[model samples]
Target chain A: MIDVFLDNGPAYLAGFRMTLALTAVAGVASLVFGTILAALRVAPLRPLRVLATGYVELLRNTPLTLVFFGMVLVAPQFGIIPPIGFWTAIICLTLYTSAFVCEALRSGINSVGVGQAEAARAIGLTFGQSLALVIFPQAVRTVIPPLINVIIALAKNTSVAAGFAVVELVATGRRLGQAIPGEAVTILGGIAILYLLFTIPAGLFATRIEQKVAFAR
Target chain B: MRTRMTRAAALGAVALLALGACASNGGGDGAADVDAGDFPEGSTMARLADAGSIKIGTKFDQPLFGLVGPNGVPEGFDVEIGKLVAGELGIDEGDIEWIETVSSVREDSIANGTVDIIVATYTINDTRKEKVSFAGPYYLAGQSLLTLKTNTDIQGVDDIGGMKICTASGSTPEQNLLENYPDAEVVPFGQYSDCLEPLRNNQVHAISTDNVILAGFAAEHDDLEVRGEQFTEEPYGIGLAKDDTDFRNFINDVLEKIFEDGRWVEAWEATAGTVLPTPEPPTIDRY
Candidate 1:
């Protein structure tokens, strides 16, 4: 197993780096977009709420593979070519994952007391100010663990990028396995280990944050 | 309870026997008549002949080579070649079970005894030889490029610098692009068919693989066309268990017979020949 990694260390590292890059970029982007969607879902205007709910439901219900297919294959028909590499993968991952992230944050926002929103309104603060300065700050604490879980899932979902010409971890393992069938098991095990390197740490971080924020309702 | 169990087992055996009989009756009307007495008593040929069935692995997606036909059985040059080999063992085409063997799993299927032989447009190479023996460089293919019919920017390999070229991952063509044309960006997919969508969308500038495979795609789609001569020689071979010298020699002998008696030409003319002109049969490498 060690020999497999040692022999092809550079290739494995390159793949590992791509996965990490994909996860980090998509993770941060989805958080921003998802938070916006969640806010919109709870916004004052019915049109904004309906739009956000429709966007979340449509993307969340669709399969990630189909989303990728649309971006890679169907997008060009509409002249929306995104250069079919890392950026394309980023677009697909962000679009698919932000919906789940939106749901998680919306649930967190709902968990906040209706009294808190009324209290913010009773004051001189407007709706946007209540959401930004008061409600969102409180909602984020409870949603951290779930949001991290979404990021972890996003890390694994990056493997889907393999089929779309983004040579990440799974694609690297497949290529190596094909080149050296004799060492396929070892190579696959090594890939599993590389994935755990990211996921396990994220899991631990989630646990730590959940405990840190363990306040009574 | 024991008597009931025994009766059930007996019924199952009878059903299987009936199915086998029906299969043989429906199979290969043009099956060759080879006498079992002509082969040595313990050879693979005699065993397969006496059993009257053979398991062969081949591609089910490659057009003009081994794509699955409308009737559910695969039809193409590879399937025809497999049928020809089975006929030599006195096995009918229907009795020859066609197992789908993708390029990546060809060696594992042979090593695990999942199939008696593989005729999946398998390429012979020194690395693969370490795991499984090969027979008959039956067809010589070469690495080439496929592009859109109206795409005038790329006429050949020289024009592909810094462009995204798609090929099957873990294939010889992928390796060729990586090693020979460092300037070209290689996008590897699981199967050659998977690259077609990307190529059509203009995500990939060209599809690079074996010339015959490219020709197969070109024949299917009006917008695609094969470009330039072959850059690397890819000798397609028959894959079987390693060190099976007798079986290897037997297959080679069968290939030599087909070449001489015009059956090889007939199989080619019926399948790949529709798209490609008939080339001289490749010389069988006995080694």
Candidate 2:
């Protein structure tokens, strides 16, 4: 059993690496895409806002695993994917996670005073400029904590990648534990440590940002 | 405020760097193989001779074939056969390395030398043989369609048309269901256990896999029954990498010895004597 770990340690490590990479990439992509979607939700055009609202509602109400499965199984018929499960997992995770992120950021945008955008407009700023200079900064300050929380959620959610056999952290730990029988505790402990390595700092960073933003106020 | 945000970002960078360092500096010597040749480096027999033990992989979830026992140890027919083979190679059962085998990953496990042999309830099929070698068609398995015992409309595999069936993702059964019942919606699960739970809940109309496995499930749950006779020939084999002819021949010889010495009968009694119908002993051949 110990020998199994000794032999397959690299595979476990590779799985961890893939998990971390996918999480980081998905998290950053969701933040950017979600912020834009949130901005659109509050834009002057009712039609655009309605479309953005519908997207958020549609995604947030659905399960992540189902999104992944649909993307993997159904996409090939439309030529969206030839037969790649890995890409399907990433795309689904980004889409699903971005919806939640959009809601969080949009709530932050709501918390920003309506007067700030009006004041910027009165000062001869265009709509984009008003949002970019006056409203967005305050919105970003309010949104940092929730955005960080979303990232952590995204990191943890990468475990679902294993459903498609895209080797990720949870699946790697399981495979390692199975390989080295009687070491399930150790293997899972290692996984926890790896996950904490990301989450702990992320939590700390979010709190730190929250403190700074609050201190400024 | 700007300085504080920069500090936080810097701290994040440091944390990421620490993670990167941990990854590069982990305890491994980093000399792992990416392919089957990594084992024995060149010779399978020599590698076993050097290690003084044989490593076998089997499932720890199926009841009669391989499953985790109440004692937290792996038990079942395939596991028993693995132990017998290990004993033949001059190693005690304790000396044998046991790894978890899932149907989705079993082939790669053998091909990559993650396991020397897979006694997982692996069905012998032509597609699998193209990837790895097999020692015995030791057990004959049959494909049976499983539906709720209360549901009488789906009488057999024939009734499965246009109904949703659950199968292990990427398995031959999934392909078989698609080829045979084109209109029946097939849902794939990561494991057989996943399919079975939903099957009992009626989330899926039928669960299709090997008949022996379905029989084992039926034996455990009185509410579940195997409806039709065996539909497919799913002979089971002990899997090894195709290049490991020496290991292959060794396992085959060990199997014959076990059959002759009545150890095979004992194994059947130990793992599935009660759940299965009766043991049909294979004709012995001296390899």
For candidate 1 chain B, which ten residues in a row score worst on lDDT?
B22-31
lDDT of 2 by residue, B1-287 (tens): 99998988887688678657756665222221223433355566556645667788999987887888544678788898887766555455555788998989999998788998899888777778899888886777777787778988788887888787877654567667756778887766576656665565455788888876776777688888677766677677888888567777767877777777787888888677665554465542212
Query: Candidate 1 residues B199-260, lDDT tens each?
Result: 99778989998888898999999999988777888889999889988889999999999999
lDDT of 1 by residue, A149-169 (tens): 999999999998988888999
* Cα error of candidate 1 at position A7, Å: 4.1
For residues A10-65, what per-residue lDDT tens digits would candidate 2 score against the true structure?
86678678888888788888888887898899889999999999999999999888
Sorted into a CAPRI-style docking class, model 2 comes out as: incorrect
RMSD of each: 8.6, 19.9
* lDDT score for candidate 1 against the true structure: 0.88
Off by over 4 Å in 2: A1-8, B1-281, B284-287
Those runs of model 1 whose alpha carbons end farther than 4 Å from true positions after fitting are A1-3, A207-217, B1-60, B82-118, B124-134, B169-172, B239-251, B260-263
Colliding residue pairs in candidate 1: none
